[model samples]
Target: MEMSIKSDAVPASDKGFYKLSWTQRIGFGSGDLAQNLIYQTISMYLLFFYTNVYGLDPGVAAIMFLIVRIVDVIWDPLVGTFVDKHDPKLGKYRAYLILGGVPLTGFAILCFWNGFSGSLLYAYITYVGLSMCYTLVNVPYGALNASLTRDTNEITILTSVRMFMANVGGLAVGMGLPIVVKLFDPSETSDLSSSDSAWFITMTIYGLVGLALLIFCFTQCRERVVMDKSETENVKVSDLWLEFVRNKPLRILAFFFITAFAMMAIGNSAGAYYINYNLSGTAGELSIFMGLGSIPAFIFMPMIPAIKRKVGKKGMFYIFLITAIIGMAMLYVISMVDSLKEHMMLVYIAQFVKSTGVIVATGYMWALVPEVISYGEYTHGRRISGIVNALTGIFYKAGMALGGVVPGLVLAFVDFNKDAAQQTPFAQQGILWLVAVIPAILLLLAMFIISKYDLDDERIDQINKEIEMKHNNQ
Candidate 1:
């Protein structure tokens, strides 16, 4: 496919690269925060809630998680095609923040409601709707990253701010959520894990907050680098697959997204189970353990540009991905030692190490999305950001599917008894593997996949400059 650039189409100030204000950066970042509030909560706690509080079997919950992702496989490209093909007055990409956010909030709230608890029909309907609505927002929000600017340094900063805010949401869900649920439970002595009402109320509060942030994001972001109406009219849903086939950088990034997100999803989903069953920890400990996962992002994310400058993208991935594997190995060894099992401090330290590695490595991968989008635009002469993001979304969700499926299947295989005060030794071992070994394996794969990504910062910058010059000559 070819794109014709009309002489009148380029705005006088449209130089292909744009600089954004602090407010614009933060505004774009808040969209991720909003998403983490709704979706990250589901990723981290939904399985636990389904199995222990809502009374579904672990296997059943796993199937439900897989099914929702399967739906995403069908839904994401459609949303991508739709967004790319039409430019709404609100904004081509930004419009979906509100359009999708409203229903997403509703479905998110309903996903936690226990009124029809354990009903497969209720679970499927709510989860499916929630996942679809998420796609509407996520594909466009991702495209918005490429739309903002072509400055690699600026995109890095924007990605840093975005990940920082996103981690704040993760910290809230990881740390504050357990505390909030416990406080809201009617039974003062009973664990919040078993209380359906606590989950319902907590989700209601989180869902509303996510909606408000979505509005904030919509107000703050503006789309500058977009295809004109005539150019967009030629976009088709098949472009999602076509772009994946033709774009080498996108393929590598897409596979990397899958591995990175799968690693995160598996680790996050298994954390509560790991703490509760494997470590015999209390709610407060679980909160701290999970919260540690995000805390390091604040410290490390700001330094990403500096890190990449020194190490280059591939070198940075190699360092951090290996660090993550080492941390996971430490956790496994610590868990297996009976003497170390009672030492909570050692467990906390290991968790901190593991989280630090995971947080920084996975956090930086998002910055790659816009780079790949630029590569595609350079090669194809049209910026099909939505289609590219859709492809990445599919792979990431595929990773998430493995995350959801692996833990539940492992639990079921080990004969994990959710209601038991203490699990069988085999069950504890399975949880340990989920927490450490499996995620470690995935990280190693991530390291390999990222090695295949050839668009380093200098190369991408050159491509952006060339694309800009082409536009100028048009």
Candidate 2:
């Protein structure tokens, strides 16, 4: 308690809370940027790598995806519990920025490797290892947000900085990967020699870049408002469950994470398939389509503070999510129509429109975690960041798993072929739905579920005041 407080007078550090050092902010933002390079690469490109480059049957690949998600159900909680329990000497949560993050980079590149000839063993090994390593990094990183500060405004600024960096990474992958891949794929020869080389080369670049960001993240970030010193005993599994059961905002947020990410993962993974077979575009065109999905973030994310201020967080969500649904529906209609303009041009517009809504809406959901953590602290007099983060971690990973499993299964049901230069008409249609309609429906469901979220400006401010009083009273 003495160390936490220099005096009864608020320190200049606390007064200038809204302004974190460039290094601290970039260091924090870099972690998510690192994650996007690895995670976003997988989300955007894994299915294509699996079916075309890795040589897995679409049906088998889908089953593998489902199995992986099922395994995640076990792994996410364990990572959460482990992160909550351990207090590494190097740094509490940031240690994983190096430890877990380094391995994550290696495994991510390997997942793109074409060796092993589509062996079920290969897909299971690299993908599962990558998922586990991601947990080690992700759970801690989620906890790190709560660790940074107790100030609501600081958290909002931090979240904004983080999302902006994340979108920058997203823009790179969405725009850059295909062009890079094309540099390798140069010819239309029906063999994956080019695709394989492209993926290996592209992933290597992203992975190395991510590794550098991890180093920066480790250097810059620090935990300020941690509750670790007050611990009577290590955080236990039961405590994790108890937090979810007792905290209303945590429960709402956890479910929200799952649905929202699942929607994102599903559409992103389907990009190569849908564009290749439906409009049947070149790698260059595919690059444009993916790039369009992320371009709006730069245009619109800066407006988030204003948007939240004007409409309220919950109100902003309702408006944007419904707008996104309209975009998705229009894209789906475009998919079904016979006499549309250049299909790529139409889809690029739809992606741009849909992304405008999806990027801002889901991106803001991240800032809610700290708010809920405050609510938990006010209610229980404990600030267990890891336990709280783990619950959110589970839903986020669950959504990703669903994203993988659903599109894989659907493509399998439609009988997608990786070996062929082209897809069956039915399979192409399925790919269209996988990218456009299925995700649209999921986004709609996400909106419905989020409508139940009760956390608002009034509740968040009250919780913050209560927690501030607790610290002051001590």
Candidate 3:
């Protein structure tokens, strides 16, 4: 379906907002879906694979995770600046989808390969390579969102569709991966541990599929909103921080990204452990539990526009953030009580509630990035989409770093034993903290940070309009 607002006097760009066809929206969304298939798999299961299949120490893996993100802190902004400073012949933002996607796919597959099993150097090389390649795709893709159109409603719908498809990728990873790995290596039925060949084959399949999706996204996206070549002539890495310093809403949103992604990272990374150790679940059950984290997205994401309309953005945030905390509390409580823990239905219900909140709240935050980008353009007269996205990417990776580091550190602290049939009660308790207590605490902090966001819809619309009018006059 295509949506159009006809006005004889105005150019499409002069209108300050453009509506996308369904194909464009879905095509762009496929990029995210692809990333989730590749990266989300890493986020959720790589640590588990490292410890169980690849023989890396939990504490050592945690430090490697930290160092990888530190490298991102330096690399992301350079990618951003380079993107903003030049327009490629292929396409400004969309070009990187293929350029980066190819290497990203290769590195993702390599991350799971246990050829150098237990080799920390190989782990660091593959993991760091994958992380850098990811930023190469991620930063520009974020810029692509802002460049698509300035229409607030369009961006909202785009985000919804993007997240919906992303969860599709998440679901594939969560539900299908374990089952597929087991299909390949049925002899080792207990869990993913020591199933090295299965992990490699699974990642190879996902990586190729992800690369294909990136190609489809590249063909469909056409950058319509962007800074003029003259305006972007002097784009610099330092501008990312300068924008952060000046753009209050960006700062707030940046912090919110940190908390929200961290909350998700910690929970997602711990989910396999939570199910396998704490619940004494089977591989199938582990798939179901991890899959539930994304399942709510299919049900609740389409309602985001309505929810935001009725409650307003911040109101919606407050409602869902609190709901997530409640669900986490239920999870924590259930695991502590034997009777409650015995009923899988109750655990599934708690996961649904918690995921419903987390999915909707975090899914909608992507829309706000465009708003902040517009705010920067209004004030600075330069729509530095790449720089803004780089800034957000840095913080988002920081959250992911915490996700990667915290689980390993906590597992190390609790004396997690890969060879043991079952984890100690203390280790079980720590896993529970990763799944529930820690994420809930972060959601509370996210609520506080998001409350600081001052650019409501009305204000952002006006800013976009003024910026467009200025462009038209020039």
Better of 2 and 3 by TM-score: 3
Winner by lDDT: 3
* Candidate 2 per-residue C-alpha lDDT over 1-474 given as tens digits, one digit per residue, 9 for 90 to 100: 334434467763563233577679778988998899888889888877787777777677778777877777777777777776777887888888889988999899899888787688988999999988988888889889878776666777788778888988998898888777766775654322346877888899999999999889888888776665547156677787899989988888888899899989998998877777777676677778888877888777777888888988888998888878887877888888867726567777888888888888899899999888888888888777877787788788789888888888888888887766778889988887877788888887888788888878777766665566566676
Q: What lDDT does candidate 2 reach at residue 317? A: 90
Scored by TM-score, the top model is 3
Off by over 4 Å in 1: 1-13, 190-192
Task: List candidate 2 segments past 4 Å from native.
Answer: 1-18, 186-194, 341-343
Ranking by lDDT: 3, 1, 2
lDDT (C-alpha, whole model) for all candidates: 0.88, 0.80, 0.91
Name model 3 segments beyond 4 Å from true: 1-8, 11-14
Candidate 1 lDDT over residue span 8-85, tens digit each = 766424766678899999999999999999878988999999998888999998888898899999999998899999
Per residue, candidate 3 scores C-alpha lDDT tens digits across 356-416 of 9999999999999999999998898889999999999999999999999999999999999
**Higher-TM-score candidate of 1 and 2:** 1
Q: What TM-score does each of the candidates earn?
A: 0.96, 0.94, 0.98
Model 3: lDDT of residue 256? 97
Q: How many clashes would you count in candidate 2?
A: 0
